[model samples]
Target chain A: MLSSTVTSLTVLLIVVFLFKEGVGVFDKTAMEEGFVIAINKNNPVDKLSSEQIKNIYDQKIISWEEVGGKKDSIFLFRVDDISNFYTDEQIGENFEMLPYRLSSLVDSFPGVIAFFPEKYLDKNFKGKKLEADKVTLAEFFGGEEWFPTAHPSAQLGVKPLILGTLWVSLGAILLALPLALAAAIYMSEIAKERVRRIMKPLIELLAGIPSVVYGFFGLVVIVPLIQSTFGVAVGETGLAGSIILGIMALPTIITISEDAMRNTPRAMKEASLALGASKWQTIYRVVIPHSISGISAGAILGIGRAIGETMAVLMVTGNAAVIPHGILEPMRTIPATIAAELGEAPNGGLHYKALFALGCVLFIITLFLNLTVEFISNRKKAHKH
Target chain B: MYQIDENKVTRKKKRNQKFVFFLFGAMGYFVVALLVLILTFIIYKGASAISWDFITKMPEEGMTKGGIFPAIIGTLCLVAGSMLFAFPIGVLAAIYMNEYVKDGFIKKFIKQMTNNLAGIPSIVFGLFGMSLFVNKLGFGDSILAGSLTLGLLALPVVIRTTEEALKAVDNTFRQASIGLGASKWQTTRRVVLPIAFPNIITGLILSVGRVSGETAPILFTVAAYFLPKLPTSIFDQAMALPYHLYVISTSGTNIEESRPIAYGTALVLVIIVLFTNLLANGLRKYFSKKVKMN
Candidate 1:
């Protein structure tokens, strides 16, 4: 009982922490929240939008001419650049001097922009402090682009990622469901016991293969095969991710549905056979309808595995954050995005929070699917009872 | 005429049955063929790169060459650390669910929660681990944080497997033990656990296989992109095998040169997982025979 309590508590804590970090991206004015961006006063650019700021930081808007300033290159600076900004002795002697030093440093570089904590901003400073527009919830949910670190503004639109994830998972299910259902039916009804004994272990072994190995295989084998087959410039497409995920999901689907089918009452099958029905007819008419709930549960579990899969999808999916038009196009999924980006996102930054929010989305989707499976299986049990 | 029509209908039914049977058989064969193909392809591609020195020495020259000793150590450490936490809690939970609690609301709820826990995506666990352990808990990117995350990841599997193992033990043995004036706890500890021990070990081996292959949960919680030295403590960062394969194959500077190494690393990982799985199957068979003898 205590162990179960701990497990539930850990899950609760994880949800809470993820939301706490994820929702921080909506802060309208970062300056009010202790962080601000300061730029040189002499620059002709009086104000900048969040989009413009992101572009500058990303070095996409390299020339001042791009941002309506004098013809000079933008120089980006951060307070953590200790070597270029301050010595250890100066920072140790007087903490207040740090802000003064920052104002002076901004003043010294005519084409420079610096970001630091709000407490470090000087009222009469030579540099000007730019107001950061708040990130709206609509922009986050409905935005078409996902260039989170774009100059002048961070684009947190997750539409492409959402669409991409759905595409790959849907494609995977489409590919896997038929094959898995056939295998399940065969294993439970058609195959001899000896064949099942040998085949069951092989299928279970498929589940045990590490996802990274699958990714490697996809990178070297599947990707090239698709490339040549389709004659696309690159083989790293959503098709490759779907194919690998379909293969990965097969074990789960086969195991569950086979169990469900095998559990059909022996008397029911006997009665169907005694009524002049063929063996295949008895399986189709009596067995399948009897275990439809279990079959759906298996499918849901397979879909859950496909949607949540990370490493293999990350390797073959091309990591392109675009709304994929077809299965052959490159795309990215939510889990792959989080796995690829979380390492570089600075802790507590908007980019980091955005990744957490992505995690939150993924969590909710899988949780919903899992609950559906549980509900279906529970209902099936209730019916039996 | 009626007899001839019935004969034609039977023939059509026979043809349909044959075709359906053939289709199902083909599907089954396809699945098996896929597994064989993957294994052979990996072995054939990776065989040339497997050398004793490549398995023993540290990586050098921007990881374009040298062995993967550090990654091997790191993977071993992670597996051990996760088992250290997951094994005990899982066993105790199973004991509570199977032995102590009656088949009632609480047991049902716990079982449901365990199912939900198992269904969560591993990358979500990665995010949770990153926030809770690495950032909020101040463990930073270290082995301890990674193991805790992975332990959480493996806990559901452990709990479910252990519960099954315990439930598989014949209830008459428990009744006999209790009828002999033994306390309930004593009967459980002395009678039930002994019978369940081999299956529990099987569960542990399976969880070990699971923990060793997982990549996403540890990606943020512990795995380093490149760390030359072996970790001396849980707090230190270390490179892990799965992550190493990911980096070299996907994002390495010299992808062409490192392809062989990626294949070799993948081969090693597959062998480890397959070995553990085989060991578990063997143990289950051995113990079941022992039970038959008893």
Candidate 2:
């Protein structure tokens, strides 16, 4: 009971933490509460929208003419630029000289835009404090791209990642399901007792192999193989990821489906064989139909494994956050995105919250898969009783 | 006409049978072939890289050369740390469920939750670990946080396996002890537990394999990208074998030069997992034999 409580409590705590952090992205104060953007007092751009500012910082708007200013290039600055702009001594021992130094720096550049804490905004400063807009929830979810660290504004649209995860998982399921079904059927029905005994342990051993090792194998073998065979310049494609994930999911699918198939009543098989049906017909007509629930359970478990897998897919799936047009193209997955980005994302920042949101999505997906497996297996049990 | 139809039917049956046989046989062969190919390829690429110094010394020259001693020790620490937390709680939970609890809602809920826990992806655990332990609880990136995450990962496995072991302990033993005037606690402590000991150890071995090989859960929580020295404390960040393999293979500065080291790391990891699995199998066989003798 204590252990079980610990298990459930862990799950509860994880969900709570993820949602709490994830939903923080929707809080306007979380991003804009303490920060203010300042521009040169002589700058023609009186007011700018958050989108325009994001673009300006991203270097997407190179010339001031793009944002209705003079046709001069824009210069970006941040408070942390200590080398070229201000030395620690010049900024005072406790940074008391920061406001003066920053205001002066802003006055010097006609096309300068800077971001700093609102407390540093001097009343007589020579810079215009632009009215910063709140990052809307719509911009995060409905946005097309996911450049979270883009200058001016972080692009937090998860559309491409969501689609890429689906595509890669679909490709994996498509590749693994048929092969796993074949192997499961063969092991349960066709293989001799001795072969079955030997094969079962070996298949379980496949699950024991570290996912990182699989990723290593994918990097060394499958990536190069795909590159050479397909004549692609780069081998890290969704196809390579799918193939490795399919191999990884095979053990799960085979074990569960085989167990389901073995549970078919002996009388049914004997009856089918006694009615002059061939062994193949008995397996397909009787054993498969009887074990359909188990097979579905296996497939669901396999899907769960493939979708949640990180390192293997991350290593193979070219980490490009683009909507892939085909299986052979480079793509990124949600889990991969989190694993790669979370290290760099500053704690309590928008990017960090966004990554946690991605985790929430991943958690929901696997939870759904788990529930489906349980439902299918339970229904099977109910029927048996 | 009847004879001709019968002959045609038999021929068609024979053809179908042959096709079915080949299809299934080929699939079974494919599974075995893939395993053999992976093992042989890894061995072929990595065996020469393993040397006495390589096993005993710390990584040198930006991890492009020398041994993986720190990583090996780090993995050992993670395994021991996780087992320290997961072992007793899991065993006790299994005992409560198998020996004490009857058919009830609580038991069902526990079982359901455990199944759900097992199905969660290891990477999600990594995220949880980073947030809950590393940030929220302020353990930072330490062995304690990483092992706690891995302990959560292995909890369901331990619970289920120990439950199975306990279930396999015959009811007659409990009843016989009770008939000898032993109380429930005494009977369980003296009789049921000893009988279940070997199987419980098997479960522990399996969880050890799981903890040692996991990369994702440790990646964010405890694993350091280039800490070359052994961790003096659980609070200190450490390099781990699986994460080392990940680093060298995917993002190393001299990926081309470090390929051999990557293969060596993978080889050592596989051997460790395989050894633990063999140990579990050996214990199961030995215990089953002893049980049969009694």
Candidate 3:
């Protein structure tokens, strides 16, 4: 009982700690560390969203009018650009008078927005500091950029990672379904008992093979084969990830559905056979329909595994944090990102918490999949009863 | 009229059946072929690297030339450390669930938690391990931290297997023991556990395979790319096969040069997995026969 309590409490503590570390990411401001965006005191802009600042910096927002300011072209000023405003001598040694010159230049331009470190600004500096927007849920989930260590701002958008996860898993399931289902169908309904006995343990062995080995195999064999066959510039593509995962998933999908198909009531198969149906027809018409829920549960479980698989994906999927356009393009997944970056991220830093937040995303997805599996299996049980 | 159809299965039906079976059979063969190709390819590439010295010597020259002795030792350390921590907790938890608790909310809750724990991704486990064991508890990326994290990851599997093993021990044996004036604990310790011991041992052996191959949880917790000396205490880090393979293949200083070493490491890890699986299966069959005879 003490052991059970320990086990339960461990799971509880993990969940709590994961969320507790991750929840702060949403509150973290999207701006760079110790950096402030300051405007002319006379400028009417009260606040600017992170997106608007990013756009302005990118020159997409060239006019101040775009952000509810004066109808003039915006002058983007950084602390280093003080030379354009004043000479080096005027700026002085150690830049003691640089803040004065910086504030003066900022005050002179109607559309000027100065970016500088917080320590440089005195309370009475004429320029008014504006609040950059905190990382919003929308941007965190839906925004495409994921440069968590970028300067001027750490882009925390996880859309590409999420989409990458989606694409690889979707492609994997698509690639795996036909082979897995057919294998399951054959083994459960058509194969001889002798064949079944040999194949079953072999398949289980396939499932038990370490994923890192598969990843290495993928890197060595599949990556090169895919490269030469497709004439791609690179070998480690989303296609490689999908192909490896499809193989990894085959055993899981086959085993579950085979069990389901075999569990088709003996009477149902006999009835189908008696009705002049062929064995193939009996399989599709009776066994498959009878165990549809269980089959779907297996598929959902496969997707969950594919999504969470890290090292293999990390090795074969190119680990590019970009939304892939096609299966051949390399992309990163949530797990790969977390594994590849967690080491360099300082403890309790913004990047650290963001990775935890990514873990949160991964957890939520897998949790949903697991619950769906639970629901489907429970429904299967209910129908049986 | 139906006699015409009954006299010969429809040509269309026959063709359909043949085509479908051919397709399924092909899929199965393809999977088998893929497995064979991977295994033989690794062996073919790595067999040259499998010298006795390679097994016994410390790695040298940026892990390109050395045998993986430290990694093997590290893997052994992690496997032993995790098994030590997880087995008792797992077996005891299984006992509490299968024997102590009846079918009710508490049992259901524990079962659900086990499933959830099993379903959590390995990388998330890595993250959690890094956060809790390495950082929060100040274990600081040592063998202790890595082993604890891996033990947690291995816990659900151990519990599931042990529970299944315990379940295989029939209720009649428990009743007979109880009828003979044995207490509940006595019935368990004296009668049920003995019967379940082999299967539990098999399960424990299998979990060893699972824990040893894990790369993610040890990535940050305990794995070191190249340590000057072997770890003498739980507080030190050392290389592991899976993580070592990962390093040489992906992040090594000389990946192209280390290809042979990478293959060797992968082969070694695969062999460990294969050995455990075979041994577990052998033990399972042997135990089942012994049980049947009794």
Candidate 4:
């Protein structure tokens, strides 16, 4: 009983830990520690929205007049750009004179917006600091950018990641459904007993292959194939992810749907045949209609796998954080994001917490899918009884 | 007119049959063919990299020129370690659910939880393992941490399969043992368990295959990119095969040069996973045949 209870409690444990670490992100500021966005002290611009700030950094806004400031070209500054102004000696060894130089520099350029560590700004320093907002749940969810390590403020928006996951998963199901359904039909009705025996184990073997191996295979074969076929510069597009995921999902879909198809009564098929229906007509019209529930359950379970699939999609999907405009464009999934980013994120930091939050999103999605599968399977059981 | 109509019907039937052949037979065979293609491709490309020396020596020179002995050992250790943690707990859990619990809400809940656990993605397991084991418990990316995480991942598979196996044993056998003056435990130990043992073994083997191939769960909890010597303790971080492959293929320093080694490692992993699957399937078939004969 203890073992059973513990096994059962793992689900709850996962949710608790994920949320415990995840929910901390919203309370922290969006900017990296000890850094702020500062503009020229004489400039009249009082505040910038996160969106406007992202736009400016992205270079969508060129002039101060674009955001209610005076008509002048805006100058962006990050500390790395220090070399553009000062010589190596003037910057000092280890940048010891950096604070004075930075302060004086900000004082001189009236239109410059500087992003630097707070230590660089002395008490008498020029330039007014912009109050970087705390990471809000709204911006985290609906925000478009995903620059977790951005200097002025890390854009922790999940919109692109979420949409990318959806697109890849959607594409996988579409590609897998027809082929899996057909494979199910063949295994159930078309294959002779001997052929079915061989095919079944091979399919199971396919399922047994590791996901990383699939990713490697995708990298070597599918990615290159997509690149050459579509004439894209690089081939790690969402389409490549979809193809690999589609193949990975096949065994699950085929197994479930085949079981359901096999359970269709022999009597019904004979009856349909007696009515002068061809073999195809009988199986298609009778067997398919009977097992539709199981087929959908399979598709949904496949979708669950596609959504949560990490290493393969991560390796093949180019890991671009942008929201994909098309399947040919590279995209990133939530699981891939967590997998790629969590390794470098310091323990309990905002970046770490954000990754855990991504985990929470993944957990909820799979839970819903699991529940749906259960609902369908339970209803199917009910029908049988 | 009647003769012409008969001819048209024959053509239509032929077309229908051809469609079925293409739709079902062709598509099914295509999936199988795809699997064959992958296996052959990996084998063909990775063949040159495999040798006794490659299998047993230490890696050198940024992982470009040496053997994968440490990684192979690491993967095996992880597999063995995780099974040690997962197997007993999983079997006991399955037994508790199958032989002890009466059918009702608790049983349903347990079943639901098992399915939910199975559906939880591998990366999520990595996150949880890193949180609870690596940081909170201070196991700190050790084999112990990786094993426990993998053990958790394997637990659901073991329980579900063992439950099914236990369910397969005839209830009459248990009742007969009890009628013969055996205690409940005695009945289960002697009568129900013996009949169910082979199927349970099959399940364990299958889960082993599963645990060995997983990359996501081990990525954070235990994987080291370039460990030179073998780990002498469970707490020592070690290089794992799947993560090794991931690193070299995508993120390693000398990716282009290490391609052959990557393929070689992938070949070994595939062999291990596929061998276990076949072993489990063979055992299952053999046992079923023996049972029928008896």
Candidate whose lDDT is highest: 4
Candidate 4: deviation at residue A18, Å?
0.8
lDDT of 2 by residue, B181-294 (tens): 999889989999999999899999999998898988998999998874689998988889999999989888999998889999999999998999999999999988998898
The TM-score that candidate 2 achieves is 0.89
The candidate that achieves the highest TM-score relative to the unseen native structure: 3
Give the per-residue lDDT digits (tens) of candidate 1, residues B1-294: 335687777788788988998899899889988999999888888888889988898987877899888999999999999999999998998899899998888888888778778988999999998888988889999999999999999999999899899999999999999899999899999999999999999999988998899999999889987886789999998889998899899999999999888989999888888899999999999999998998
Could you arrange the candidates by lDDT from highest to lowest?
Answer: 4, 3, 1, 2
Question: What lDDT score is found at residue B153 in candidate 3?
Answer: 91
- For DockQ, candidate 1 versus 2, the one ahead is 2
The residue-by-residue lDDT of candidate 1 on A257-338, one tens digit each, is 9999999999999999998888889999999999999899999999999999999999998989977899999999999999
Q: Supply every candidate's count of residue pairs whose N, Cα or C atoms clash at under 3 angstroms.
A: 16, 0, 0, 0
DockQ of each: 0.65, 0.70, 0.78, 0.79
DockQ for model 3 equals 0.78
Residue-wise C-alpha lDDT for candidate 3, range A160-179, written one tens digit per residue: 99999999999999998888
Query: Regarding TM-score, does 1 or 4 come out ahead?
Result: 4
Residue pairs with colliding backbones in model 3 are none
Q: After superposition, how far is residue B190 of candidate 2 from its true place, in Å?
A: 2.4
lDDT per residue for candidate 4 within A240-338, as digits (tens), equals 999999999999999999998998999998999898888888777999999989999999999999999999999999989997899999999999999
Q: lDDT tens string, model 2, A1-385?
A: 6766887788788889888988777764223457778888777887665557777766788887888988888887877774487778998988788888888988899888888887877767998888655556767667678888775556777888988988898899999898889888999999899999998899888888898999999999999999999999899999999998988998999999999999999999999999988899899999999999999999999999999999999999899998779989999999999989988988888888888888988999999999998998889889889
lDDT of 4 by residue, B83-139 (tens): 998899899999889998999999999988888999999999999999999999999
Let me know the TM-score candidate 3 reaches against the reference structure: 0.97
Error of 1 at A286 (Å): 1.1
